[model samples]
Target: MVSSMEFLRVANWVMNQVLVKSCYGVARKIKSHSFDWGDLSYKPLQQPSSFPDIVKCDLEGRGSQTLACDFHKVLLRTRSFFPYFMLVAFEGGSIFRAFLLLCSCPILWILNYEMKLRLMIFISFCGLKVKEMENTSRAVLPKFYLENLNLEAYEVVASVGSRVFFTTMPRVMVEGFLKEYLNADAVIATELHTSGCYFTGFLSKSGLLVKHSALMDYFGDTKPDLGIGNTSLQDQLFISLCKEAYVVMNEGKVMPRNKYPKSLVFHDGRLAFLPTPSATLCMFMWLPIGLVMAIYRIFLGVFLCCKFTMALGAWCGLKLNFKDNNQKKSESDKGVLYVCTHRTLLDPIFLSSGLGRPLTAVTYSLSKVSEFIAPIRTIRLTRDRKEDGETMKRLLGEGDLVVFPEGTTCREPYLLRFSSLFAELADEIVPVAVNVHPSMFYGTTASGLKVLDPFFFFMNPSPKYDIEILEKVPRELTCAGGRSSHEVANHIQKQLGYALGFECTNLTRRDKYMMLAGNEGVVQENKGRRF
Candidate 1:
C-alpha cells in the first residue's frame, strides 16, 4: 500500500510539471505575437498650435456644436486620482481593502501612469459586488465630483449643446455622474470585466480604451467642433482629431458652492474629506486614538452631568459654541418645543447640554444603538399624523421637548421642508440653528448603518458644533393663535435658514431618500425600535 501511494505522488508531480510548461509555452507565443514592451513607452508628440484657454473661448454659437473633453483632466480641479479610488475601496469594498490599496502607494509612485491606474483598479474593484459599486457611484461619488469640479470647465461644457467625455477610469465609476449631473451626451471610458455579477478586477478583452481611437470611432469622417484636455501627449493626440482644441492648465480653483449646476442637498457617505494618499494614512493612524476618545466621550455623556461632560470634552478637542437669545419662558405650564435644524443625531444631546438640563428628543428615525447610548430621553415618532402628534404632546407635557422639524439630517447648507406636526403641538416655539464641522467623517448617512452615525462623528480628532437659540415665536405666530400649522412651520424654517445662512427648500425627507437611497426614508421597526 505504501509503494502504491509513493507511485501516485510521483505521477501527480510529473503531470503538474507538464501542464505548467504547456501553459507557459502558450503564453510566451501569444506575448511574442501580439504584445511589445516598447508600445507602453510614452513618446513625445509635437505641441498643437498655442491652444486658447477654455475660459476665454467665445461661447456664441458654440451651443450648436459638438464638444469632447477629458473628464479627469478638464472637469476636476485636482490632478490626483487617488482620492476617488480610495472612495471606491472604502465604500464599495472594505476598510481592509482600502488599507491595502493605501499600502501599495509606494509601488504606485514608481510605476507609470498606465500601470498605476491598472493597479488601483485591481485593488479597488477586485471581488466587489457590481450592485454595491453602482450604489456608491450613484450616492457617494456625485458629491465629491461636484465639490472638485472646475468652474471654467463647467461653463464650457454647459454651453455646448452636445458633449462627449473620455476617461481612462472605469466606465461604471464616471458614467453615472457625468450623464446625470453634467448632462453629458456620451461617455467613452475603459470597461471592466465581470463574472457572475462580481468584478474580476480586470479590464475587458479590449483592454484600456485608447482615447484617440475611441474619439475617432465615435465620430467617423466628421471632426468634433471642440476638444478639451490637459497638456499630456495622449491628450494632445486625442484633441488633434478635433476641428478645434483647447488645453486646460488647472490653476487649482474649485467651483464655488453657489456655482454648482445642481444643488447637492442629499448625499450619502461616511467620508467628509477627500482621501488623498497622505490624508488617508493620517486617518488610519488616528483611528486607534479616535476610537478610544469616542468611547470616552460616550461614557462621560452617559454617566456624568452635562456640565462635566462638556468641560471634559472640550479638553479632548470638542468645540461647542452656544448663542442664547435669552428669550423669557412663557408663564404657562406647557413646555417649550425647541425646534432645531437637524445636522446630526447628536443635535438634541448637544442642545440639552447647551441648555444645562435634560430634554426629551423626538426623532423620526433613530438606531437602537443610538437610543441605548443616549444620555437623555428619546421618543420615536410614527409617521401617522395623529399618533405622532399625540406622542409629541405627551413628551412636551412632561418638560421641554426637542424636535427636528426637517424630519431628517441635511449635510449641506440647506434646510428641508419642515413637518407641520411640530408647529401644531407647541404653543411656544424656539428655533435653534445647528451646524457641525467634522474633519474626517460625516456624522450622518442615508444608505449606511445608522448605528455608527454617532461613533463616526465622535471619531473625528476635532469636531465642532454651533448652537444658536433664536428668539421664541410670539403667541400670535403659533398655531394656538389661529395660524395654520404649515404657516408656523414655514415661519420657523425661514428663521432657522436665515440664522444658519442656509437656503430653504420645499424638499422633504422623502425627496432626500429617493435621491440618495432610492427609498421613502422609512425605517423598519425591529422589536418596537425603528431606525
Candidate 2:
C-alpha cells in the first residue's frame, strides 16, 4: 500500500508532467502561429446597398422606396430574429471552432460568454453520499437561507452570516421545507441551493448568491432588502434594530441538546444567543515544503524579484501596506476576498509573486504552461453560480482568495463594471487597484491577437503597476440591507477609479466583446444563410 506522503508526491509529479507539457506545448504552438484557437475574423458578404423589397413598398402605401422602413418593421416584429442582423466579428467555420473550444473548456466558455449551464447529475448522488456519511451528525446552523430572517436569532446564525437571494422560486419551497421540518419560517444555513440549480461544488454554489441576487435586483435598483447578517457585530445590530423598529421578536431555537449556542436569553423581548465560535486546533510548528521545494521556492522568489524589479518593476513605485494592517487580518489569515481590476494576465502573476507568499488566483481557464510555471496558485472557475460561490467560501475557509472582479482585462484607461459575485463572498473584502504603465510597448488590449499578448508583455522594457491595497469595506456597512454586493461593487469601482484617476465606463464584459469581437464574444457567422 502506498503511504499518504508517497501518494501526494506521485500526484504532484503527475500534475507537473501533464499540466506543464500541455500548457508549454500550446504556448509554443501559439508563438509559432501554427496552432491557433478561437480566431474569429471575417468580412461581411457584399450585396446591394438596398434590396428593393416590393412587400415593404406595398406596406408604405406611398411607394417611393418604403421597403427599408418595412424591412426594419419586419425585424422589429420578429423577436427571435432581431439579434441575427447585429454586427458579428466572425462567421462560418470560425464560429464552430470557438463553440467547440468553449464546450471543451466550459469555464472559458463562461468567460467569453457568461452563459452558465447545469452540471451532470452525479452531484445529487454525491450530496446523498454526504447525507448518508454523517446523517446523524447535526449540521452547524447556517446563515442566509431565509430572507428577512428574524434577527433576534443569533446562535443559529453562526455558521453562515449572510445570504444573497438570486431567485424567486424556492423561497416558497425552502420556506416550506423549513416550516415543515423545524416549524420555523427562517433557516440559518451556511449555504443554500435550490433543487434545480444545485451542483456539487463549493465556489459554484457560492455563485447562487450572485445569481439569485442579480435576478431579484433585475431592475438595477441599488437598494435591496438584505436582512441582518449572522456575524457577531450584526447580531448586536439585530438587537438594536429590533428595539428601535419595534419589530416583533421570537425566541431563538435550542437544538436537541448541545447542538446550539452555549446560552440563550431574551432582554426586553429582544432575543440573544451565544453560539460558540468554531474551535481551531494548532499542532506543533511544521514546515510546509520539503527541503528541496523550499530551496527552490527561495531561489524562485529571488529570481522573480530580480527579473520583475529590473524589467517589470514589480513592486517599485507602489503604495501598499504589507503589515497585518487590516483589523480583520486575523480572519483573513484564513481567507480574504481580494477584488482587483484586471490590467493583464501578468496582473495576478506579478502581484502574487511580489508578495512572496502563496496567493491563489481565480480565472476562467487554466493554461497548463501558466500552471506548471506559475509563481502562485491559480484556479479556473466552472461558472456554475452556486458551485462557484461555495468554492470561494471554502477557499476563504482555507486561505485568502484573490479575484479580478472586472471579469476581463481592460487595456483602455477605463474600468468596466465589476462582477458583484466576489463582493458577496466575504465581509472582509480588500479592494486592490492595479495601475499598469508600459514603456516602449503596451501589454494590454481588449481586442488583439491572442498569441501576441504574452509575447508583447515580455518584450516591454518595463511595466509597472501601482497596487493600492485599500482599507477593507466595513462589515457593518454590508449588514442589514446597508449595501448589496452590487452596490459594494459599484462603490469599489468608483473608489478605484478615483484613486487611479482612470475613467470608469458603464460598458461591461459583454459590451466589450460585442463592440470588439462583434458578438458577445461567441457568434456563428452565416448561421442560417442561403447560398
| Location of the lowest summed lDDT over 10 successive residues in candidate 1 | 35-44
Candidate 1: tens digits of C-alpha lDDT, residues 1-531:
579545544543453344323433444454446332221122225355467777777777887999989998679875677889989999878889899998888787677877878899999999999988887898889999999998888888888899999988899999999999889899999999999999999999988889999999999999999999877778888888999888886544788888888888888778888877666766776676678668767776898788677876676667899999946867679888899999999999999999999999988898888998899999888789999999988888899999998989999999999989888887888889999998888988887778888888988867899999999898899988999999999998998999999999999999988877777877643421011
**Cα error, candidate 2, residue 9 (Å):** 32
- Expressed as tens digits, the lDDT of each residue in 101-124 for candidate 2 is 223333422332112212211211
lDDT against the true structure, per candidate, is 0.83, 0.40
Q: Candidate 2 regions off by >4 Å?
A: 1-328, 445-452, 479-481, 522-531
Q: How does candidate 1 fare on TM-score?
A: 0.89
Report lDDT (Cα) of residue 9, candidate 2: 50
Which candidate wins on TM-score?
A: 1
Report the Cα lDDT for residue 408, model 1.
Answer: 94
Q: How close is candidate 2 to the true structure, as a TM-score?
A: 0.39
**In candidate 2, what residue range of length 10 has the lowest lDDT sum?**
277-286
Question: What TM-score would each prediction reach against the true structure?
Answer: 0.89, 0.39
